[model samples]
Target: MPDAIDLYDPDGYVDGPPHETFERLRNEQPVYWQPMPDGTGYWAVLRHADLVAVAREPKTYSAARGGVVLEDLAPETLAMMQDMLLAMDPPRHVGYRRNVAPQFVPRVINQLEPRVRTICREIMRDAAERGDVDFVHDVCAKLPSQVVGELVGIPEADWPQIHAWSERNSGGQDPDFSSGYSEDASNATIEMAMYAIGLAEQRRAEPRGDLTTLMLSMELDGEPMTDIQFGSFFVQLVTAGNDTTRTMLSSGLLALLDHPEQLAELRADPALIPGAVEEILRWANPLHYFRRTATRDARLGGVQIAEGQKVGMIYTSANRDAAVFRDPHRFDIHRDPNPHLSFGTGEHFCLGVHLARLEGRVFFEELFETFPTIEQTGPARRQRSNLNNALKSLPVRLCAV
Candidate 1:
């Protein structure tokens, strides 16, 4: 047995791959108990099948009970959070997500490939000229913000603010990323919502050919989405799109760097880029887990969970569960039939998944094509939070052909 107490500190393995700890937990404690910094505790579903069962039965496992984190939010904060799609239960959740889902359909997202490529090329060209750049901020972060910006019809000039707000919203636990507390994060969220509300009002007055226009014109249950609703929705899309895609590209590069053989194969055959992207999602899923509360007593993997108890689909552990994945620890770019739960499963699968995939495939294609001699120049810095499994810094030297 490993010396580490697996659930003693959930944030301990936030920096790099926690394969060792996760492996031990999967074998010994599939439903590990984690005591939070507060007096609260939760059941971490550490196996693949168990996590999927939790997500599949939303009626039994609710996202709305006590909120989705190990540390329960204040009642007011929880009320504020209910505006987000991820926090809603069925019927309401289904309606809201469905309203926005059509815009993110595979066909619609596929059409953005050309624009994604252009953005990636511009970012790469800029980095190539610099010779050395912080890959996370200068290169990887740009793509998602630009993509989300265009989708929402935000001006290019406002992209920086949007990025900053998204960072603050997701970065509450990381002192380096935010003011380091929920109050600050809440304030940032309010500011972002207010900003989004202004844009919504403007879009309502004169519709533009963009997502903001579509959202402003959209109706949920024959009523237009309130400014408060739009605010939460905007924050979710921008924040979710920003950090997760950023991690995919930045961490994907880190993975490629670690495995030069796979990198070479990808370089030799760019068609493998899409397959490689899937492998990256499998190998470096950006989230540790997402929480759900059991509405009533339930049995998962023969373990009983009571009503109002917090339960998480431990994606990090599930992605590497030996039951679901052969050689689960290996980083194989050619691995077919990948069943990673990074975008999640069942009712709450990420709406922006198609867009994320497009950005990943196109960005890497441009990255490999533009910079034939790219090398990691320094160690990467990880985001300091259990919630966001992301890199804060990635230093690389690029040589443009």
Candidate 2:
């Protein structure tokens, strides 16, 4: 008889936390088998240690083979996605990661805290004056687009277009969330790539002292990145920054709302916001999981995973793994020695981790400081996607201090 594997239904994970089912899987079948809607099933690595092992052994488990999603991307789409840093396999992945590492290093991101604060203050001000606003659009969405626009040489005026495109690129997975349009994600990806190509062409003539300049001048394997290459890089940075950071802000607020005492603690001691940010990341990660494919047949956590099969390193599950965190359900902002996989693990860890954290810390600090009496005036709504676990609407009212 086949092993009695704890099977989790993906539909349960779409709206929000799949705590009960995930808890059962974690305790009973740490390496669970989950069925896909399209008649396929995959082994879910539910334990934190197993996830680390899967990430570390990239030679056996690849990001390139079947692409990251449960269903394989079309050949053409797969080729385009392979150009992304997240999807590329080693030697190339290593080289590209190294090339961009200097730009996003901790010290560099740390310097942007003041600028981040300014952006957050402006965002808070715009929302505060309204008294009531859709927190997702008015508040959470601004910092990401602005930060990304500043990072690249994109003009501030063009931010809305970029934001729209970024939303579309990440949105095709959710028909309801993405303007109720059934636009193909591949088309959006191509459009974004083309937009970046134009920007690269413009920057090539007169290099500004910004990230666009860096991309234009910087060499990849002794060759300066082509316009096509810059397109891939631009899409990756823009879309990743757009979706994930927005999730952080929106979800972080939800966490605070759920934990009143912790929220009060943060208000009393603003210094605790730093640790609170870490806890937020741990408690409610922006992404559900990042999928990786196996290059060769491998055994992970004693389960025999077939070659070329897609495997997801579920940060959502790993962050709450009983072995890794104590009182895992509790949101303790003051929790120390917290090591969460919100940014991922291993060499392929998120390059924008520091910047994301800096933005989160500054945004929350400014939020509490400016609006002392912040509360959810209406019901919160969630996005409809297994991939993007975020709020669609948080009806909030903030009283100006």
Candidate 3:
């Protein structure tokens, strides 16, 4: 088994993403078959071009067919997931996304910058008061929770509960974040969905000027969004908004610290923060991969993928593809034309892309400005999950300016 590499094992990711193995696979077999513990396996698409090809042709590689994870979810769970934009295919996905796209466009997202910056300032001030913190939970997690909560018009008091549910949903593979039972993860989804359903009911009666009200008023397939559909969509938005942004901020800090020269450069020139965030995302993408099932037999990277087989567009590998990225392994804030697939591509590109970039840019700018000296106090711990490439804990000391 010396030559064997298990991409399916969550434990393999606890230390870090298996980049060395990924490089080897990318070189030898860009489209490799990986076996899961459940006696099933997937074709891991390691090359950037191949992954993009799979994403572009959604008709051939359906997100709705089997849902977007390697493990087949429970029948009910898969049904609920199918309602989300991430799991929907082109024609239907297009309509659902179009209904809400107005809310997340650059103009709409830019309007929230001042609020986002204010949230960052408050969070940084709180972190400064603490002096030392588990940066992941205490610092990085707050901005997204508040931003998303306010945008959705969820009561500020419920933000923590929403954050908790989001963590459990994505951190099911990590014991630090979830109970060993899969039921707990499912329950988190159900609980969040129920909360959303109640909120939708309230908004329908007394409409407000928030995304929730906008979504509730909008129609999909020429019919108003049903309560259950709203519930599913809410779960997707909250979970994606909370988890991925938190990961980006925490992981971005760690990446900056790892390269102090780059960190200093950013501090010297704050204008570089936006590019730095992009590089950080490319280096440490929040999601490792999203799954899609082949609708019919097709050839990918010269390999035959049979119908109904799971295919993983391995972003972690594709981000560092030597063919696309010059000096791929080296972290550079000024990596121009860095076409990383971190936010994905094609029809299923991230809905909150603008908001995420805004949060990232503002959070780092505020963090550096508020605390002149920020240093890691201890070892960073990573989440044990193949799907979520995230840090579980990052201990740091923030010295106030």
Candidate 4:
């Protein structure tokens, strides 16, 4: 009905998200059937309400049954993904999340504000020194890498490697970021997991007051988390934390720069930075969608979905759903009751929501304070990936205050 929309093609997302296509799909076919190259296809849950319904009913729409990606992953990779919280179904998901959730609660995350601010200050100082910089990599990527490394007690020297592996893992569709080989992506995950396993072993022998040690000490399903489990959990935490936070910061800056008046408002009253962060998330959600498989024959958005069919909770469309946000296209920092599904919903909601928000707020605060003038030096480049709604490069000039 919508002129053969191809939501599965990574090429379609090279410039940016197919928001126009998404808008049309939401209007005509909220539960659109999108065919993938592999003959199998998923029901793209475009509307906000429908996506929520799918997410709420984990038993009906299972993450583990097919893993989270639209394409079928290799058996080993799928096994690793199943180990991560994102791809697990309850009550296993519940047990594992319960063990580590305490480390990420707002009260605990708030305690890291001072350190996050320090890191942001350092990043801003470096960006100010390099007046012209690729904001995506030089400015935005540094904070998450450092923050996650510190959080997980990763060796300072290994941070860059972890970041590189993360990029490869998430950037498989982007040739610039990835080698364009599926094996490379899988290898990156395995390599990271191996590294994480070693870290767990080291931390086990010499416990430290860090997340790594805490996680290793925690019990899942009435037993201590094994090294393999820690490896999967570590991979998820580092990769998710790094890529999503980088996207948020880079995209958030571009959004503010595009709307100078809103940017000015943020600079005038830094208190509004948090609200602006939410709007940024709503506007440019880092990940486009997360895949789930129908565990049984089910009906969603008036369409019948058979068992084993993939279902994608398309956050890009849902965030801009007219039914949810009034004037959803407008980038308003003060959008109260902003219920964007960027961090997802239900049992698999993001574990690092507080940390992500804190990083966003502090990074913006320090950025505006450090650089009074931020100008776009060149056109921004979006990542070529259906899953990752992130920028590949954002060239900008920053003038220090």
Query: Who wins the lDDT comparison?
Result: 3
Ranking by lDDT: 3, 4, 1, 2
For candidate 3, the lDDT comes to 0.94
**How high is the CA lDDT of each candidate model?**
0.85, 0.82, 0.94, 0.93
**Tens-digit per-residue lDDT, 1-401, candidate 4:** 74568999999988888899999889988999999888989899999999999999999999998899888998878988998989999999998888888999999999999999999999988888889999999999999999999999999999999999999999988888777556678889999999999999898899999999998888866788899988998999999999999999999999998999999999999999999999999999999999999989999888999998999999999999999999989999999999999999999999999999999999999999998889999999999899999998999999996
Judged by lDDT against the true structure, how good is candidate 4? 0.93
Off by over 4 Å in 4: none
Clashing pairs in 4: none
Which stretch of 10 consecutive residues in model 3 shows the poorest summed lDDT?
Answer: 1-10
Alpha carbon deviation, residue 112, candidate 1 (Å)? 1.0
List, residue by residue over 170-233, the lDDT tens digit for candidate 3.
9888887788745788899999999999999999999999989998887867898898989999
Name every residue pair that clashes in candidate 2. Answer: none
Q: Which stretches of candidate 3 lie over 4 Å from their true place?
A: 1-3
lDDT of 2 by residue, 1-50 (tens): 14433233434555677766667777777767677766776677778898
| TM, every model | 0.96, 0.95, 0.98, 0.98
Check candidate 1 and list the clashing pairs. Answer: none
Candidate 1 residue-wise lDDT, 1-401, digit = tens:
54456453536865565777778878887887776767777898989888888898989998877666666887877876777888888888898888788898998889888888888888987888898999999999999999999898888899999899888888887788777576678788889989999988888888889988888777765798787778877887788889999999999999999999999999999999999999899898998788998899988776788888889788888999999889999999988899999999988898888999999999999999998988999999888777777899999998986
Q: Where is model 1 poorest over a 10-residue stretch in terms of lDDT?
A: 1-10
